[model samples]
Target: MDPIRTDVDAPFGRIADLIALNARQSPDRLALADAQDSIGYAALDALMDRVAAGLQRDGVVHGDAIAICAASSVAYAAVFLGALRAGVAVAPLAPGSTPASLARMMRDADARLLFTDAAAAEVIGAPGEDAITRIALDASAAGQALADWLPPPGTRPFPVDVQPASAFNIIYSSGTTGEPKGIVQGHGMRWAHVQRGARYGYGPDTVTLLSTPLYSNTTLVVFFPTLAFGGCVVLMPKFDAAGYLQIAQARGVTHTMLVPVQYQRLMAHPAFDAHDLSRFQYKFSTSAPFNAALKADVLQRWPGGLIEFYGMTEGGGTVILEAHLHPTKLHTVGQPAPGSDIRLIDEEGREVPPGEAGEVVGHSSGMMTGYHRQPAKTREAEWFAPDGKRFIRTGDIGRFDDEGFLTLFDRKKDMIISGGFNIYPSDLETVLRAHPGVADVAVVGAPSVQWGETPEGYVVRRDGHAVDAAELLAWANAQLGKTQRLARLHFIDELPRSAIGKVLKRELRELNPS
Candidate 1:
């Protein structure tokens, strides 16, 4: 059976048609804004046609795989949409990822061509095991070059039919466990997810201030919905607390999304209190579970503005919590999105009842086709149910309430089986953060000879707040279960976080020797 088409056509309606619609309807309206400058819908549409022309000229044919490795810019979007129009599969690599990682992704995704900006061209130009054709993506020159190739306002659109099930883009895994797996986002799945998200709240009138990197699935899902709804996007090439607030005020941005740490930083910023941020309508956060304390802090400051969604890139949005519902269900990730279903199942694949912890499995049209080339993993995630429906087994573990609100319990892999007892690190970290001197904490399962594997607490104290390791350990042990207690303590000045401020526990695990 075919998947549902949420939008006018399929969400994967030809990129050419979508761009042309925006150009015709909102020609003069601003579509993209960044540190450099803003570009309107008409200008962007014309530029995309040009990019498409250039790709065609370069021998890029339909179904060609292209790598987009660069920072956030208007040209980046033009190239991405242009590639889609040209029927090329896009694989966007993170800017900060090592060349080794980049090579792995390119090879894994079987990308034959790379489209990169000048800044990171040197890094992305390095040859891998498999040779790839490199093309320079000059943001400044793209519009002109495209115009040269096709002539802006005169470039002929490609005569191609891109089906919804056709390969649209490849979103790589976070690589938290093993090498990053490329998630296959079909033209239809991408469109369905974007439409579902936009219909929920993200719309044309909304001004989305993006602080996350362009490579992230969050950015991919958010950007299209904002554009489809005729909303303006203010791009933060890289996240900066002070800069974000300034941009929010200067641009009169109505909506934005950030990880939990970014939210904390915004609240911590001294200027946060000085600014009149009443215009801010909705703020969404994910990538990590949020704490009730942090939610309270944001609510006390911004009132009804916080929104949360629970889902990863492979699947689009699963659950959505609005600002109004947030107060009633503080820790819940909210209810399932429309046309989506969630189930909690045990390791043996048995359905677990409400209040019982199990793996969170989701089913929706927005879910990716599969992990690129990893047939084994794909088969496991996208399996058939007894009801003849398809479902993806999210590695995450969570439980539901009687009211149907979901609360994240822990990751299936991250669960510490200490002395036959299952312990969730998040539970320990939350308790540790309650202490006055403790600023932030992460709990990991360290190998233990006696109990097989035991939980270890790593804490970063507030500046100028000195607490002895013994005292901190004692306090943590008092609050935790006998099996969940920290085997040891590692006091660090600061935790190494990702571009989005997610604590890199893998780094900590590598840094701290067993």
Candidate 2:
């Protein structure tokens, strides 16, 4: 497990340069595609040049932030790369965020221009006093159309000086409340990802189907690598189980990145096994917890290597669980990746002994620069070892097994304290998930008059099954320690999730009586 070499003098310093190199070598190859359109390597290279020129003409230069709030599309991809080509940083704001939040993010990034499609524009409405220049990706009343926004076809922007430390993009954290913090990633971090991705079989012949939003780091972790290695990427504006299966089979897709919920939906689809997915060489899952049972099912049924990546968007250490190779370690998140260091500490900031759960913190080369314009928040996220090495606090509670595999228990903030005893929600959630009647479940700390804070369970019943909350609670309590018993249980239609399928525990906590 050698570290990914950082080659400052590589043939292509920037990702845009890599795209240009691919165009020169494989002119006729498909560079990108969506349901409605496709672009060749040569044409995509040319389009990127025009887009860079257009931004330059509008006074966008190095270090400037260009905000894109739209659905995934060929134009959206082009604009993202174009901004990078001009040495500008991109802030991919989520269209699903509220208008006020979006406005705050735009201000935080100091974006002078905004690119959006009709649906996103409708959600955002007018820019008002934000003073952002608007360009529409589709027909909309929001701003100028993309076609009119660009300069002539052959136009090229001036040459840029890109360094390893140059700002690359701003990824906003999915905060449960208030304004989200913008995590600033640099070119060096992205370059490390692109270089290391080759071990997973990304190359010129690779065809990656990305169904996640471009706004998410989960998608870009695979998306940028596919293009950097000269692979074709197929974009899905919105995820549909049937459509995903159809596209994968029809296009002979070779690789893909999907969240756990998407995988659950695909596995439940009636036509799941009906399609031919033998061409898939690798599949990735991240951004949420992947159940061990689901991983085993995928390994047994799906025709590809299933790799689960455990890490934060803030980019400290990463754990890679190759379910195909280490079937016995499926319960753990595997060992830390090469060049990554992970440690656990207790509440008093002391290093916890091995096999004892503690707050997970880590250090790695792929770490983000800092939270944009939030120096105090950035400082709060860091921890230091005796050797003076800096580590990012993951805020997760996990312990290493004798074999060095890491098993996560629960988030530090989600831990329940009942009657002066520490309780891990994941320990309780595991028991609940084993129940036949439970389709999905989330455990959160609820206010309890007797115990201060007690564990509560929110459950989604399996289809065609009737479950009484009291009955289910009694059954679950039978398998748990007395102190860990659920104080209350609530039946819900479904768990509230973020766009990337992360369960929103904050929202569930709100449902509990104070």
Candidate 3:
């Protein structure tokens, strides 16, 4: 495959520059929508330009990290793009994040300016004792407040000849260790991913529903595809089952990506079947693996609407499950995307054969800039292949079938070995979730005096439905091998999730405490 290349001088030096170019090409086209309000490409471009001017007037300059704490709104987008236009890097903090979390992240990132809306202001507060400039968007006037808040003239624009490797934003991962690590994304990585998304039928005519929170890297992948195509992004203030369907129908949204849990909730809503989704062209899902039954259910109901793509936040890694393979090879996360490479290797670092599970390694031009200064961890993740190609170890385990399709069986870090038998939680959970009464389920290992460790199934029931533990146990035991069957079960209202909606098995294990 040819190496990824970026067109820096064609327009804006970075992804933000695409906004101005789109404004000129399709000025009157709707660029973004939030609830009932919408903005055309020209209006959004002009508004973001003003924000850039204002930031310049306030002494915000290139290379500075400005913290933006606000809900997903056009104003938030303006501040994000404006900071970039002024050559400043942005650290978009979750609006309602706790003080300690916010403080630690701000300190770690060395953010010098803070921007927030009123509600988040109450939680995050102004940059009081901290060495940072403060800017607040009055939620009372909506996002238009930025337009009237003028900047003095002659604000210098960033030099157009900047390097493509320049830092654009500092995003933190949901650290399993309780302290997040900052992930530095460069202009080159951003453009590469944007172009990859464009190849998936995203363009000027596309309309995407921003169902996930903007702070999520997943949202960046979804929303920016539309932006790259000069298409409209319909942003919801927050996710609600009915609200999503209503917006999709109302705005004629063609594409969306949601967690399986969100899709389940949407299907549970009374108005779900009432909405007309025939216009829906593409519906992709990730953040957690979905059961084959769920894929079959969607395909049987929506025909050609569903596509599954697997990705990780760490290395900009992605694998798109082709629509043609769904329900046929339902266990796989599809094949590697264009301009990418994937391999499954064993402990001795040799490539594994078909149907044998091994660690998944990948290479992409869009990977982060070595997890923002953690040289040791970055070096550990990156290694040169025998063919002189570099690949990042994804920390995931999978296998390839005879047909060359990929099947993700487990996370290498999440595997459980019980009584000398290796067991994958995903293999068990996929079967458990197929039970009609089980709405969602997660499988983990629980300590046992006899077996050392046994599989535990944490299940959430469907609304107004109940499952007898022993009866379900009998059903699972009869179908699964003795070692793979659930040794215990617990009912819960909802499973704990990270912001991006992945099941937090670590928390589940902690709570159960064997």
Candidate 4:
């Protein structure tokens, strides 16, 4: 049975059809916006047709995969939608990655064409991977410009059947080093996401500002929904606190998806309050741990509903924290979303009792099919029940409270085992963050001489607030349990993060491993 129609008896309507409907209804309505350009619904819809026609004219067939490695732009978005119209899978890769890694990913996804821009082409080092052809979104002299590559404006793609299990897009995992895993999400899973647009008040009037990289699911989750529902999406190629505030006010943005770190930065910005963001109807955050204190500050100051989404790109049981309604439950990631079956399991894969922290595994209608072309790794990511139902392993250690709200305890791999006791690094980091001088902090487990593994703290101090590493470590340990005490603490200028603002804990562990 299909999950996208939302109602069990309702016929599934394609998101592309909805876009076409939107175009027919409101041709002049703004559909997409970027720093350099903005396109109305009718023009954007027509552009997609041109893109699809060009792909077909170039011998690209249905079920084949193409890639887009450029930063977010109107052209990038057009090509993506165009590929879907042609029943072709898309692999949206990150331009921030090394050339070798990006090339390797294109090969892995079996991408025959790479839609890129001048900046991204430079990063990919000439796009010299296999027989892949390159088309420049920014019209660089090095490759075929998007304008020239696209078919005539009136051209339309031939119709193709897009079934529930048809491939949608391949989102590469955020592995800073080495070959990243490509998560294959299908059209059905994406349609479910689009169906959820109504919950966030998405419509023709909804304007969303997406500052995160397009490659990250954190950005696409909001991007697809806004466009599908005839809303305008404002893209930010690079995230800047001042620029974001400016865009929000200028665009009259009603919705946005930001990681916790982006929120922290926005909240810390001196001019954040000065911005006129009264149009915001909803603000969504995911992809990293959100501090309760920060959520409180946003609720107190920002005008809109703040929702925290807890789930992975692989799609499993989802938890949604509606901070506006449940003020007291801000510390937790809220209860499982409707129809989301979230459960906890012990080390041996046995289901854990309520209130006990364990690895999170979930089953949902929106879960991914599996990792692309990696059957062994895909099986490793799945957990089967005694009844033979499949669930995705979240790799996050968490617990369900009496009310079913989940409180995460860092990643399962990040959890430290010291003297046969579990030590969650987030627990240690939370305590350390309470210090007045700490601007930011991350705790990672290090190899230990006696305890096998021990917690080590890396900190970024508030400017002009003096606190020695020894003093901060001693203070933190005094507040922590005996087994949870830190083994060492070091001060740093900043905590390293990925493009989407996830803390690089592995880098910290490697840097200070005991």
Candidate 5:
């Protein structure tokens, strides 16, 4: 039996089809917007057609990759959708990545045309000796500008067929070392996501405020759904707590997907309570461990159904915790989503009994096809069940409660073995976050002579709060088990995070002495 449902005929076969339909049905509705500009559905559709024509004229054909590294804007969205319309896969590279890494990824994707804005072009100076076309989204020294690159108005691209199995986009992982592996997400997978998202209240009247970068899947999950459902999307080039609230209130935003750090910042901002967010019908949090305390605070202060999604970009079984409905289960990541099968496996690859901690693995219709061009790495990411079903290994240590909710401990690689005992850094960080002086905290294993490894903490203090790291460490240790006690504590202004707000634990580990 195929996991994806084939019984019901979907209204649109591809994402581009849905966009085209919306343009014909609601031509004057707002499709995309930013602080500077907004585009209606009709104009967005025409722009995408021209973009497809331009790419076709420039030799970007079916299955070929087109790389875009720029701030989110109307033009960026057009280029992305236009590539899809032309049956080409998009490789949205992170602008925050180093120039060397960016260049390496472009080579790996074999991207024929590279698009960038002025700010990103400045950072990504020049393309390597490899011959590739560079098209700047804005005026810059980076090859030709958008106006010069696009084909003449009314030029139409040749029709190309798009299958469900066709590659839709390549999302690179946030690996700190070496080149990041590209996860190949197919059109069917994206369609599954869009269909599933409609249940969460996305529709023609829905307005989604995207504060994260377009390159991040966390943003695309909401971004594509809003457009596919004929809703409006407001893009934020850079997230600011004050500015987000103002936009949310002014735009009458009905939906949003934000990481935990963004929520924390919004909650901490002085003006957060001043704005009216009652228009929000649904709010999403993912890509990090959201503290239960913070979830409770948001539920109390913010008006919306708070949902937390726990899964990886590589696609596996997803766990959805509706924090608004299940207030008591806020500690867990909620139950497995409908039709999603989740199980825990021991280090030896044997399935663990319920209520026991093990590596989290899952199977679902929405899983990615595989890591791009890396068969060995792709095989390493899979775990086969006895019945011959394949599951994606999440690399997270978690246990299911009697109620079937999953409680995550830490990353499998991040777990510390101290004196032959497993020490989960998340357990220690949870205790540290409870401290009044501790605004944020991250725990990582530090090499030790006494034991193979021990826990060390990096903490950020609350505003206007003065407390010694030694005193806070002592207080936290008093509440923790002997093996979980921190060996050292350091105070920093803020914890380093990725573009989507996941803590960079590898960077913290590098600070520890070997």
Candidate 6:
């Protein structure tokens, strides 16, 4: 039995502590790698030590928050883990966010120490204007370089006694401005995430490839587990289909966590079938709605287990679909994960019976503590059951089949009200995608004088297919009920997407405001 496995099976364990133990047990093992360089367990452990000591020397105390708004890098990982070792909460700001949003997040987290890389620095600007002490992850960025900012060699900070409920990190939600929804995830929540990895095949010999940036909670779910179980990590600063495939093949990568759009691109790549991904053990998808056709194509072509995780960054009510194991249930997002209490609630806040459509609410040991400094907003997101137990509202409308699988509808806010009827945009988008010529699509409610709000679609044409928007709209409406017909269809080169690959429906709405 592996020493790390024994530690991983404990009731609750800190990721930082587990990494420390792995360093002692397997000092020579490769712990992290990027396009430019790699580091062994021993060196990584010492590097973390230097980071923690340097932070302490700079007066960043335990329980205080610090932010990192940068691309993925070996140094970025060390700073994150090292801060955890010191009991400080990390706020990973999305680099793809507008410069104003990033700066606002720093203020929202009350973070004084900020970190950035060369790529992010281009947008985030120079750092000396405020009280923030910026540390540049790479050379030529605004802040102090990590090497020059570190404490002396062989340095170690005073050890911290970490508790499970201590703040682990603050993950902000998607927004351009105003008060950010900083979700404060405790160490307890993260421990449950690591514990759940046993079933997914994460272990010391596992080499997990991460193409997503370090800031996303979507990426961290898999990134943290690999380290806690003594596995190696390979980071990609930017994600491109051909480059991602080359690195996955060269590194003998066993695992990866990609959002749905990345999978779509990979499956469409001509060289996808040519790549030798025989060593792959697990491939994960999350953070966006996955298309059934895309999932089917991957299952038919891709090697290894394909798992789709449906959950929020706020950490409640997780649903897992192991596509390889249950090939028939490709449309449903699987049953509730073990130990997760998933329930459905009506608009009146009453719990609904199974087999009926309702909003998704979930309770689990892995739920977040609360939104940072936003008690009202946090309370708004919770619903107390008759037993007084708390459940996080998923804001998604879904129905459970008699067998317990969940078929998701559009978000409650996104559900269109047309002629006093509820029209799910996902239903309309599904029809448009079936036309074969439509490569990507997004449906939003357009202001309608007659129906109040009607479904409007924005489409991207598949290469070499020239289907007229008006004709496709008519065809889709023919397949739909009278109330669910599309108001208009606009063709574009591509669907606007977030850095994590979620369709930017708001952008689409703004572009075609009625």
Clashes of each: 4, 0, 0, 0, 0, 0
Pick by lDDT: 1 or 2, better one: 2
Candidate 5 Cα outliers beyond 4 Å, as residue runs: 1-12, 176-178
lDDT of 2 at 118: 81
Q: Where does the lowest 10-residue lDDT sum fall in candidate 5?
A: 1-10
**What does candidate 3's lDDT look like per residue over 371-477, in tens digits?**
66678877777756789777778778888888767888777767888898989998888777778888888888888888888999898987777788888877877
RMSD of each: 3.5, 2.4, 3.6, 2.4, 2.8, 1.3
Question: Model 6, 503: alpha-carbon shift in Å?
Answer: 0.8
lDDT string for model 4 (1-514, tens) is 3222243223344577667777888999999999999999899889888888888898887888999988898888888988988888899999988988888899899997888888888888854335588888888864788888888779988888988788889999999433689999988888777766668888888999999988899998899889887889999998889999999999899999999999999999999999999999999999999999999999999999999999999997688999999999998999898878999999899998767988999998788988999999899999999999899999999988888889998898888999999898998988988888998999888887788998888999998899988888889999999999998898999999998888988888778655
**Candidate 1: where is the Cα deviation over 4 Å?**
1-16, 125-131, 138-153, 198-203
TM-score of 5: 0.97
List TM-score per model, in order: 0.92, 0.97, 0.91, 0.97, 0.97, 0.98
Name the candidate, 3 or 6, with the larger TM-score value: 6
Per-residue lDDT, model 1, residue 254, is 83
Runs in model 6 lying further than 4 Å from the true structure: 176-179
**Model 6 clash pairs?**
none
What does candidate 4 score on TM?
0.97
> Residue 102 of candidate 4: its Cα lDDT?
89
Please report the TM-score between candidate 1 and the true structure: 0.92
lDDT of each: 0.76, 0.89, 0.74, 0.87, 0.89, 0.89
Candidate 6's TM-score: 0.98
